[model samples]
Structures are given as structure tokens and as C-alpha cells.
Target: MSVGDGRRPEPRYSRIVGELRRRIESGELAPGERVPSTREITRQWGVAMATATKVLTELRHEGLVRAVPGVGTVVSAPERATAHAPAPTAPAPTAPAPPAPAAPVRRSTPSPAAAAGSPGGLTLSRIVAAAVTVADAEGLTAVSMRRVAAELGVATMSLYRHVADKDDLLVRMMDAAIAERPLPADPPPGWRAPLDVAARQLWGLFRAHPWLAPAMSLTRPQLITSAMVYSEWVLGSLHRHGLDDQSAFTAHLTLLNYIRGLALNMETEREAEAQSGLDSEEWMDTQEPALRETLEGGRYPQLARLSRAGYDFDLDGLFEFGLQRLLDGLAVLLDEGTPPTRA
Candidate 1:
């Protein structure tokens, strides 16, 4: 559709990409010159973080820019063959130009921390710590080799010496974080006591690192030794309760999944707040009128009564409530001396 014809405009990222491409091609942003970071783009363009991220991605896809770890995203150096070649003719405006194939990014040599001017030099521990800090402050989506390198004041390739890749860095971060709260040296004697302690400790870990709960998985597991300590504690407690190996492991997983299920809400709520600039309470307040109208239909008496009386949806309180109920069910099973067993 024509501009005046009621067609929606091109995506915000497309426009940003075009502008940046023009700058790079015109030598305004010369080769190796830093381009706007996602945060900068958001501030300059008055756009959301996702949109800003898309702009950078589009630039990278077009081979107009590349991420340089510690230096940030920069204009890509022109290929020797194209260095003096005439500019290609613009595609007909009848339809948008097809996306150009992305060129492989060139990795710069890794520099030693001392050479990079990092005080006290870099260590694997420092790398993991910095990555965790990034994940905690921003969502997991914000963590990248380039971002972490920028955080640590070292070349992106330097991280590879300590961490094999981003996935490896994530595992190291998870292990480092879980190690912060070790299982008690002298755990309480009872099976229930130990299980309670482990669950609460895991809860605390998830609370401190919102990205953690979502990053961790029961089905597709990561090899986090500190996390294994929790598993060992939980499994041992279940075994003492007279469950067989399979049943004990299964029960341990059940309890873990329960805590992880509730913990997921923390990250989701944080992301929602960041995007909407409204916390859970404020968001709910905004929806109160709609909630009230829905309740007025009289289809859900219990919900209407609770809404009228006012209920606080506290995650911590809810976790405690659910924990006790789960323990109660396990208690009944143990008391009956008929712990669940596979047929």
C-alpha cells in the first residue's frame, strides 16, 4: 500500500537498520567505530529494548556491523574485493529488498587481563561473577559473550580461555551462585527437616537470581555440581522415609519441580514490570475494574467473595502454604508405611 493508503508503516527496526546502514556506507561510522549499543538505541530512538535489539540484529544480518566483545558493536570492515567496487544499484521499491546473506564475523585475538588494564587480572571466577551480575540486573536475554566482555573490560575471545562458550559460562554461573548457600553442615535429624531446608535454600537462590529459576530445568538438566548437592540431600531424605531408589528420586524431582514452578513467576513478573513500568500490584490495580465486572456476572461465587474480602497474592506466603500442604501429603504417606512404589 502507498504511504497515504492506510497500510501500516514498516517495522521500527527496519527504519533504524536503514539509517545505520546509510551511516556505515557513507563512512560516517567508519570501520571498527563503535555503533550504538542496545541501551543507547533505546534512549536515542525512544523504542523498547526488544526493538533496539532487533535493530542491532538486523545490522549484523546485513554484514554492516559486527559485535567486537570488549569494544562493542562496530562497523564491519569492507571486503577487499568490494573496497573500491561501485555501490550496487538500489532494488526497485515495488517490494522490500531481499535480506543479504550474513558474512562470518571475524574474531579478534584474546588479550590478557593485565594487557587489557583490568585490575587484579581476570580469573574464571571473575568472569562467572560478572556474567551472573549481568543476568541478575538484566533478563537472561541481555547476557552475551560481547556483553560480558564489555562488562569485564576484556576481549570477547578472552572469555573463551576461561569459558568454552556462553552455554558453558551459564553453567559456571549457576554453579557459582548455588555454591553461595551450601547445604547445612549439620542438618536436622528428621527427613522432613532436611527436605524443608533444601527447598527453602533453593527458594532463596531463585529469589536472589530471577534468571536462575527459568534457566534451570528438570527435564533437560545442566551439570551444576552445587545444584547436585540439593538433589543428594533431597534424595537421601526420601530414602530415609522408606522409598525405593526410583520413588525417592521421583519424589525429590516432584518437590524440586514444585519450588521451580513457583519461582518462575518471579522472572516473569520482573520482565512484565520492566516492559510495562508497572509492578504486579500496580498492574492488578489497573485491571481491578475489569476484574470486578467479570465477577459481577455471578458465574464464580467463590472468586467474587474472595475479591470482595481482598486477598494478598504474596508469592512467599503462597510458597510456604503449598510447601506445608505437600509435606502434609508426604507425612500421611510415611505414617501409613506405604510410600509410593513403581509397579
Candidate 2:
């Protein structure tokens, strides 16, 4: 359908292409000069890579840019301007003066401040900070070496000098995020209190960076030192409660799995909200009718009764209830020398 006029409207990417064309035509970006890379376009214009790439591709198709092997894509020499060049005429007095000379291009190097802020020059800490900021604003899927470089205001190649690859960057991000959380030096008088504190701290971190949940894996765990320290703290806390090394390690694994599993759901829910533009409450409202119809059919009488009683399933409440139950089960094992329930 037509948008404003009888003719069909232009696609969004076309508008981006037009603006880029104007920049090249105005000599804001000079001929043979490097154009903004797709990565830079995405960051500066807040467009997806597909859209940004399309803009560059369109420019190439129209002979506005050509790819250079060593450098990147650069503005192409204008054909018409090269063919028909007017000899310089005397400047018109009445005409507005030409704009001031364009500023000199600045070559950005990694700053001493950035290097010093890191433990060593261009250390994992700085790399993680850049990655985390990208994940924080856009979801983790949007994070990559190219994207992180755009965020750091550096070329994509510079990021590779610090991190091996995108996966390495993500592992480092997880490590850096975990390292910020200091483990308690001494366990509380009992295992329950300290474990509870540790679990809550972890939960808070996951909630703060919702993308963190899925980044972690239980099966093939990333060998992150700080993450290992957290496990060590948990195992040591449980060691005093009459559990052997193997059992204590198992307990630590189980507890972490429980927290991570629940946190995963929270992260998924938030991601769904972001993609669909529907908040959790709005999503629940849409599902309520179908849920009520099933629940009220008498197959789930207990659940129906609870629903009718206006029960709300909150993460904090669920965590507390589950934690207490798990602790109770642990207490039973500690007192009676029985094995704890398997997860």
C-alpha cells in the first residue's frame, strides 16, 4: 500500500543509503577515503547489521564505494566529476562562503588510561568491560569482535589483539563479572547462612546481567578462574557440615545448577519481552484465559484452587521456598548421616 503518496514508500535502508550518498557528495567523506564500516554504521545509526550492510552494498552497486584489500571499503571516484570538470571560476562575492575545511582524521590508539585501568596492558579486564557494555545494551547475541570494537571506538582488528575470538571474549566477560563479586572470606557460623548469602549474591549478578545465565554451561563449564573460586568457596563452606570432598563438590554443583536453571528462565522471559515488546505481565494476561480454562477443568484441582486464591509466582518467593527446602534436606543429611537428596 502507498504510505504518503500514491507511490509505494521507500524502505528504511534506502533512506540510510540516501543520507550516506549525501555525505559522499558533499565531500564530508572524500573520494578514496574510507567509508564507515558496517560495524560502525550499526553502532552510529543504531541499525541492524543487515540494514547497515545493505547501505554499504547499495553504495557499492551505485559505484559510490569500492573495497580495498588492505584498508576497508572507500568512497569511489565520481565518474561525472572526473569526466566533466569546470575550470575554477572567480569566487562569487554574494554567495555564502564555502564551509570551513573538514577536520583532520584522527588515528585512535588504545589509551594508556585504558591499559592502566586493566591489570596489564590491554588485559582481559578491559576486554571484558567492552564486551559487557555491548551485552548490557543489546542482548548477548549482538556482541561480537566487530561490535565491541565499534563500542570501543577502535578498529575490529584491535579487539583480536586482546581477545582470541568472540567465545574467548564471552568467557572473559563472565570471569570479569564474577570477579567483581567478592566471596565471603569466612563462612558464617553455619553452612546454611553462608550458602544462602552466596546463592543470593549469584542470583543478583544474574539478574543484573540477564544474558549471563545462558552464557554459563553446566556440562562443559568454561574454565574461568573467578567462577572456580566461587565453587571453591561453596565447597569449603559445605566441607564443615560433615560432608566428604566428593559429596561437598556434588552439593556445590547441585546448588549452582538450581540457581542457574531458575535464572535461565528469568533471562529467557526478559529476552522474550525485549524481542516481542511485551512485558511479563502483558504476556501472562494473554495466556490467562487458556491457562484458566485448562486449570478449571478439574484435572488440576489443587492448582485451580491456588489460582483462585490469587497466588502470584514470583522468582524471589520461589527461590526462598526452594532454598529453605533444600537447606532442610541438607540439615536432615547432616544430622542423621543420611545422603542428601539428589538434584
Candidate 3:
């Protein structure tokens, strides 16, 4: 029977294997080039880890890829047939009108407009803008150096003049995105209002680029100058409460970590929905029956009451609640010189 005529068709892993095979055979991905990792396959193709791993394993079994100790899985030389093949022969008699010289195929280079360079040409900013546009549309997994170069209509090696590698390009994208945000020129009235405004502004930035939350590092914090300026704003706000430099810095770090952690959850939720084909509402709906059954049993009375109250548990509400409580504790310390109450 045909695929949709009754038979359930071959497994998804088989399809993945076939596509990768075609890419190798068509010379789109060259021999010795690294194959997509299991994590990459899962993210790019929206498949489970097991399915992605199975696809790679099947390719390896077919001798298409071999795992090199230091280099990871790379396309094998046996799979390089299309790369070295000669072009097909044309009919001889029909073409012989006159002994005309063949016209040269004009190769295109990266234009200064595309690369956003000065009169000299090809700056890092142009390369990063191109990369960011790709990631914004297709998600972060699509933002490779080669992909960015393709978007810029340049040789991949030409990108190296602007960016060191993919990692460098990502860092530059983060900085550029951060630079677009405008922090307060001067502090607003009181510590509460300015801090609230700053936090909300950063949160808005994450909402604009949902992928960015996970890309940032709180501990090693990418050191983007604009991001640092915002951090300084937060630190300065905390200083108004009479906290010393170290205390102020610690408070700033704590607030940043909280925001980043929550924003990462939001990013993960989006990715999970995209990959699983189940949106947040659908996922929650599936869980509701089981959750209702459990809550109705009433093993924990207080928890049951809260669940019955229909709390939506929104992230914004949670953030506001937590921030106010934290600031209240700080207020207590400021007012009475006593230890603040800890939840």
C-alpha cells in the first residue's frame, strides 16, 4: 500500500536519515564536514532526542558518517561522490553554430551595503545584523557562520574577517540587541520606581527576542557595555537604600539572576511547544484531569484549596509579587535596622 493509503509510513527517523543522505549526495554538505549533533537535530527538526540519535546511528551504520575522537561525527569520504563528479555532457552538433567563446560566469561578492562597512568595507556590525535577522526568523540554531555568510551573499571565509567564529557572532548579536534598548538617562524618583522600570525594560527586551534569555549567562555575564550600563542603573538604585557597594552589587546580581531564570523558563516553554506540537494551554489541558483527580483526593488540604481558587500563576504576577516582597524586606531593614523577614 502507498504511504497514506493505509500503511503508517516509515518512522520519522528514517525520513531524517533519507534527507541527510540526500544532502550528502547532492554535495550540499561536503565530506569531512561535521554532521548535525543529536541536540542540534532535535532543535532544528523538532524531533525527540531518541529519534535524532537514531537518525545519526543509522547514517553511521550506512558508512555515511564516522565518529572522529576529537572532531565528533563527520561525513565520510565514501559519501563524497557528488562533490568530485563531472558535469553532464551536452549534445555536440546542435551547439556548433559558430566558434563562439564561452561567457564567464560572474561571481558575486559581498557588497558594502550588505556588510555595513565604511568605504574600506565589511564590518563586524553588518555580519552580526545579518546573523541576528536569521536567528530572529528561524531561531538561534539556524545562526551559523556559513548561514550568516549565505544571507550576506559572501564567502564563508569572508565572515572570518568580521567575526572570529559562531560563538563570537552570537556574542556580538546579544550586544547589538542590548544596545538597541534605551535605559533611563537619569534615575527616577525613589529606589522602587526606578528598579521596577529597569526590571520591566529588561523583561521587555527578553520578550522581543525570546531566544536571548537562554543565550545569556548571569555568572559570566557577556560584558556587553549597554547591558552593563543597565546593571549599573540597578546598582545605583540599590545604593539609594544605604547599602554599601558590595551589598548593592550583590542585590543587583540577585535581581538579574531572578529575571534571567524566569525568562529562561519562558523561552523553554516556547521551545517545548514548538517541538512537541503542543502549546502551553494544550499541555496544561492534558494535565488537568490528572491534576483534578489528585487535588480532589485532598491529601494536602492547603494545596487543594489554592488549586480550587483558580490561580493562573502567571509569570508577570509572580515576578511582581516576589519583587515587592523583596523590596519590602529591604524596606524593613532600612526602617528599623533589624533583620528582614525571610520567606
Candidate 4:
């Protein structure tokens, strides 16, 4: 509160930036040491992600920090003053000492504002592309308007010109990603053929971009035009096979759910790998002893027998088997002229 009118205080981001700057300047945060990530900053300062992002942006503008890929932001080495020092001179006893020099404005690292004005300036496509790159490399949780802006070297506020908010940006990202592998121009003859192609294409997209599977919502689906293309294609195929609107759409949804359900594991595996520094095979190897011990107790004879035979967990194989069985069941319904019952 102000003395006179009780006006609001300085922005929370500014105060947070000051505290972080103090830590960096005071050597409390050493060079090459990882600073708190945006998420951590949000928790520590009880501020929003945009505020946390601004704090780091300010630090970078002053050349106190730099972002390291896969390592978050870190304190950079202190700037040496040798290059700007005036010639050494003996001071006269009577002469008044020169007033202390002001701190030089160090804009070593380019600000996002500056980058936003450069050639091929910021656009909606660029914003979505930057966001997708970040999500693909670091998972969905790592993505935010601020983070994407940082990746594009543009002001976080500038992103609003392209997207309404984080949720809007995410929908665009999904739309763009789905658009990457468009449905084939010429559809195959039979219902199963096109359905197979569509399912496989969706799986391919999910495999390539692991974050996409979980970001997608089944309950309240976003209006992503490119994604709707797939739905339209599948529904047409199913309808041509003599199924009613509800039955065809139901079949499409069932197939989509199956593929998405399996793809959900991809992000989980990636998270586990990053956190534990072990891939699926290496992780399974580490757990072999305990797994064998539990199975050997005879609590599960079938699993024990399979364990002795060395079962290899293959997600792709499981997906294929399930897909075929589902198609077979759908084929039976189509042949017998039985409409799918609503759940």
C-alpha cells in the first residue's frame, strides 16, 4: 500500500526478479548451477507461471543467466570488468575522489522483445511450432506460454496475439500435429482398409509425439479441425458398411479409444526414463530379481511359467492383436446387421 492513496504495490514479478537477482549477484547461486525452473519458481513465490517466466526473462536480459537445453536455466559466469576499466592513475590526495560509477546496463543476451521484431517476425505458425518443439522434447508439463515464448525468443505477452491462452495454444498444437500426417488422398476400397490406415496413422503420430496422447481429452474434446478429419474419414467408412449413424460413430470412437489408451503409455515410459535414467529394458533388468522372487512363491503359477520362458513386453504387438480382434468383432456385427448398443 502507498502512503497517500494506498495504491497497489509493484508487480509481484518485479519483486521476485529482485530476489533472484540478489541470489545470483551474491554468489548464493553459483555459475553452471541450475536455478529453480518455472514450476519451482511458481511454487516458491506463489506466483503464476507467467510471473515466474518474467522473473527469468529479466535475469537473462541482465546477462546474469542463460538457458541450457535439457538443463533448465543456470547462473552464468560473472562479467569481468577488465575490458571497460579506465587507465590506471595515481590519485592526488587533495583531489576529490570521482563519484562511484553507475552500473553499466548489460544487455548481453537478447530480450524476447528484441527477438520478436527480427526478420520473419512472430506469427501464429511460429508460435505453435515453438510450442510443439518444447512439448515434444520436454513433455507437456514443460510447455507454457512463457516457455514457448522463451523458445521462440519473443515476449510472452506477444503470444496472446496468436492464442487466447495455454488451453487455446494446446488445441492449435494438436491441430497442427494432426495435420502433419493428413489422411490419404485416395481412400482404400473396403471399410477395413481405410480404418486400418487411419488407426495406424494415429498410432504413428502418437509414437512420434509422445505428449500428444495424454494432452488429448476424451470427455470434453477440443474442436480440432484436423483431428475431426480423421473422425469424418472413419465415420464415412463405417457408414458405407451399412451401419447406422450412432453405430458408425460408436465404432469410430471405440477404435480411437483403443489406440489412445495404448498411446498413453508412451508418455509414461518417457517420464519414467527421464526420472530414473533407465529405459524400459534396463528398468526391467533392474527389477528382475524381485520379480522372480515374487513369482517363485507359487502365488501365480501361469505367470511363473511365463516368467521362466522370458516374456518380452511389446506394446506394438499388443496394439496389433487388440486391433485385429476389435475389427473381427466389428465385422461380425456388420455381417449380422446388429447395431452397437450405447454405453
Which residue segments of model 2 deviate by more than 4 Å? 1-123, 336-343
Per-residue lDDT of model 2, residues 1-343, tens digit only: 4576789687878888878787876667766677777656767788875677778777777777764322356676554232222222442122121112101111133343444433234445555776776675566888888776665556667777777898888998888777767777876777878888889878766765667888999999998998888887777778877788988888888888888888787656757766775444435446767998999779999889886665444566677778767777777766854454443
lDDT of 1 by residue, 1-343 (tens): 4899888998888888878887877667766677877657877899976787778767776777764322346676564113332253552112111112101111133233533565447678777777777787677989999988887678788888888999999999889878878888877887888989999888877876778888997889999999999888888887876878987887788889999899888788778877886544445556877998999999999999998766645567778888877777777766754454321
lDDT of 2: 0.68
Q: Which residue pairs show backbone clashes in model 3?
A: none
Weakest ten-residue segment in model 2 by summed lDDT:
97-106
Kindly provide the TM-score of model 2 when superposed on the true structure, using C-alpha atoms. Answer: 0.61
TM-score of each: 0.64, 0.61, 0.60, 0.64
Model 1 scores a TM of 0.64
Q: How many residue pairs clash in each candidate?
A: 0, 0, 0, 0
- Give the per-residue lDDT digits (tens) of candidate 3, residues 279-338: 443354467678879988769788888866544445656667777776666666556444
RMSD of each: 18.2, 18.4, 17.3, 20.7
Ranking by lDDT: 4, 1, 2, 3
Clashes of 4: 0
Q: Global CA lDDT of candidate 1, please?
A: 0.73
Lowest-lDDT window of 10 residues in candidate 3? Answer: 98-107
